[model samples]
Target: MQAMTYHGPKRVRVENKPEPRIEHPNDVILRVTRAAICGSDIHLYEGLIPDTRVGHTFGHEFTGVVEELGPSVQTLKRGDRVVVPFNISCGTCYFCKRGLTANCENTNPNADLACGVYGYSHTTGGYDGGQAEYVRVPFADVGPMKIPDDMDDEDVLFLSDILPTAYQGAEMGEIVDGDTVVVYGAGPVGILTARCAWLMGAGRVIMVDHVDYRLAFARRYAQVETINYRQVDDIVLHIKKMTDGRGADVCIDAVGCDASGSHMHTVLGKILKLEGGAPTAIEWCINTARKGGKISLIGVYGPPWNMIPIGTAMNKGLTLRMNQCNVKRYMPHLLEHIRAGRIDAKGIISHRLSIEEIPYGYEIFTKKQDECIKCVIVPPRAA
Candidate 1:
């Protein structure tokens, strides 16, 4: 089997590796068909996430066909086509029972925070991801959803992570009818977040990003207003003016740790390693939201020590909600939306490369080159 292995920061290559097998009674072995390089994967590639070991595989959004099933797995069979949620949950834990699978206590019990997530760093549980010809899936009955026979792999691949993540971000905004919403970042998640806001009855949706191509992509695909933050002297003031000085009713931070707005944050966080990751986007969200407005953070943040404007949030009576998305909770609902043609989830894919070309795929995506918005990796079996 050929798998994408991480060597170090900005170093990855597809090389022959041993195929995974069923380790637990509930495990299943998947012959990967489609996998994606997430924006969050860049954090691991850049060494922003802690405990990301060399030789680790780094992908979580994937769909595949079950090649083998463990003894206890009764919900699926060897030939079932499935899209596995990134979060590995037991489905019977306190958090899982409450539909908060991202914090499942039974998975990654060694960690105090996030539950086990495929292909994330060791902090989230050192489970290898699906950026390979074959991969192992645990707690199979609870995580992998059988794909509809009428749909293609591309149509459901993102339900593993980004699509549900974007939907959860919009849900956290508490957007009401005729509410004005502003989304920071125009990446895949941001674009989808903007689209989801409209479905939630937001009267207006604005997406922000310094990258012109992504902003343009969002405007065309997500059908929302876009702001190129690089052109403005003060993004906070500009957003305030756009909202008639009341500020946006809801603001979302889809750009997380690697945000590149403030010099101090970049220098200290990315360069000096003094802070977790840059809090530039979160700051913008806090500063630009209206008093008593809701702010949703769907962005990936590493350590808890990043500097935040807590005083300002408290003073303005803002509502802040954030978490690693409970992807299982929204998969069925979003799948229905996709089936109804309300959301063309596959339209966001800008690049599709073979598994062997993953390194180059990473280069173009991280550099924001070739107008790349999303990149999917097709293993040989599916290609």
Candidate 2:
């Protein structure tokens, strides 16, 4: 099988690799139908996550059909179309019981270190990922959700990651009826963040980004107002004015480490120029947040922190919620929403290509070309 393997920094390749088999009795193998490249994949490509080993496959956002099942996997059989949750969790764990599947203790063999994840690294449980011809799904019964036959792949692929992540951010922000919410970053997750905020009854949703194309897309597709930080010198002041001087009631940071004051200061230096001054989305959130408001962070982050405004948060009495999404808990509800036509998440997809064209797809997606919002990799079906 040809799989996208992480060889090293700035180097991922489509190479022949061994096909995965069910190693655990509870595992099931899926013939991948569609897999999307996530922003997190860029972090790995840039060597942000240490778990990415040479030859490890590189994706977590995917949907597929069950090709085979382990002896104990009775809930699903071959031919079941399913969306695999990005996180692998054991339903019996304490964290899982509390709906925190991202921190499941039992499935994370390296729990003393970090939560285990598919196609991440040995530190993240050493499980193989789905950016390949097929994948072995650990905790199959708990992780994979059967999708309705009538639904398209792009509509529900997000249940695996971005959409749920965006929803989680909105939920954590405690967005309520008539509240004004501001989301930082106009990436795929940010666009979905605005959509979810509106779905939760937010009166006005403001999406912040330096990229004119993305901000425009947020305005058009997500049904939210957009602020191009580069074009506006005083984002905080402008947001306040837009909200009648009360500021945003809820602020969600979807840009993660890419924003100013983030650990990846060097990267921010590169992209911030497009948005003018420092790319301080986090700072903007603090400056523009209402007192007692909630600030939710769903962007992927790495080690060695820097330049966060603790005093601003303290003075404003802000509540901070940060972490990865517990995709398991929200998968069922989000899938229903997709099937019911409540959300048209597939609109975020800007490109779809065969697995063989992954290199080209990565080039365009990495450069974020032609208003590229998201890219899906569809491996050719087995002959």
Candidate 3:
């Protein structure tokens, strides 16, 4: 089997690896058909996430056919086409019972914070991901969803992560009818966040990014107003002016640790390794939101202290909600939206490459070249 293996920061390659087998009674083996390189994967590729060992496979958004089923796996059988949620949950834990699968106590009992996440790192329970010809899936009954007979793999691949993540981000905003919402970042998650805000009854949606191509892509695909922060003198003031001097009713920070705006944050976080990640986007979200407005954070941040404007948040009476998405809980609802043509989940895919082109795929995506909004990896069998 050929798998994408991480060597170090900015180093990944397609290398021949041993095929996966059923390791646990609840485990199943998937012959991967379609997999996506998520925005979070870049954090691991760049060494921003801790304990991302060399030779680790880095992919979480994937769909496949079940090839082998463990003895206890009764929900699925061999030859079942499924989209596996990135969060590995036992479905009976306190958090899972409460629909918070991302914090399942049984999945990553060793970790105090987040639960087991596929292909994230050792901190998230060192599970190998699905950027390969074959991959192991644990706790199969709880996580894998059967792809609809009418849908293709491309149509539902993102339900594994970004689609649900974007929906969850919008849900956390509590957007009311006719509310004005601003989303920071024009990456895949940001683009989908803008679209989901409209579904949640936000009358106006604005997306922000410094990259010209990404902003343009968001405007066309997500059907929202876009702002190039690089051109604007003050992004927060500009957003306020657009909303008649009252800041946006809701603001979302989709750009997490790798945000680029302040020199000090960039120098200290990305260069000096003094902080977890740059808080530039979070700062903008806190400042641009109206007094008592809601702010949703879908961006990935490490376990380190960030210089946030907590005093400003307190004085303004802002509501801040953030979490790693509970993907399994939202999968069915979002799938219905896709089936009804309410959301075009596959519309974000800009490039589709074979497993052999994994390295080049990462290069173009990270560099923001070729107007790349999203990239999907097709295994040899699927191709």
Q: Which candidate achieves the best lDDT against the true structure?
A: 1
User: lDDT by residue for model 3 over 207-293, one digit each (tens)?
Assistant: 999899899888888899989988999898999999999899999999898777478888878877777779988999999999999
Off by over 4 Å in 3: none
lDDT of 2 by residue, 1-383 (tens): 88888788677789888888889899888989899888888777666555568978888898898988899997899989898888888888888889888988887767754456777767678777888899899888888888887887777888998999999999999888999999999999999989899889999898888888888888889888888877887888889899889888999988865454543555444333222113366777788899998899787766434466879899999998877789988988887777777778898888988888777777777677877889899888732
lDDT of each: 0.93, 0.81, 0.92
For candidate 3, report its TM-score. Answer: 0.98
> Any idea what lDDT model 2 has?
0.81
TM-score of each: 0.99, 0.92, 0.98
Native-referenced Cα lDDT, model 1: 0.93
Per-residue lDDT, model 2, residue 52, is 69
Query: Tens-digit lDDT track for model 1 on 100-144?
Result: 999999889565879999999998889999999999999999999
Better of 1 and 3 by lDDT: 1
Residue 72, candidate 1: C-alpha displacement in angstroms: 0.7
Give the higher-TM-score candidate: 2 or 3.
3
After superposing candidate 2 on the true structure, give the runs of residues whose Cα lies further than 4 Å from its correct spot: 112-114, 260-264, 267-279
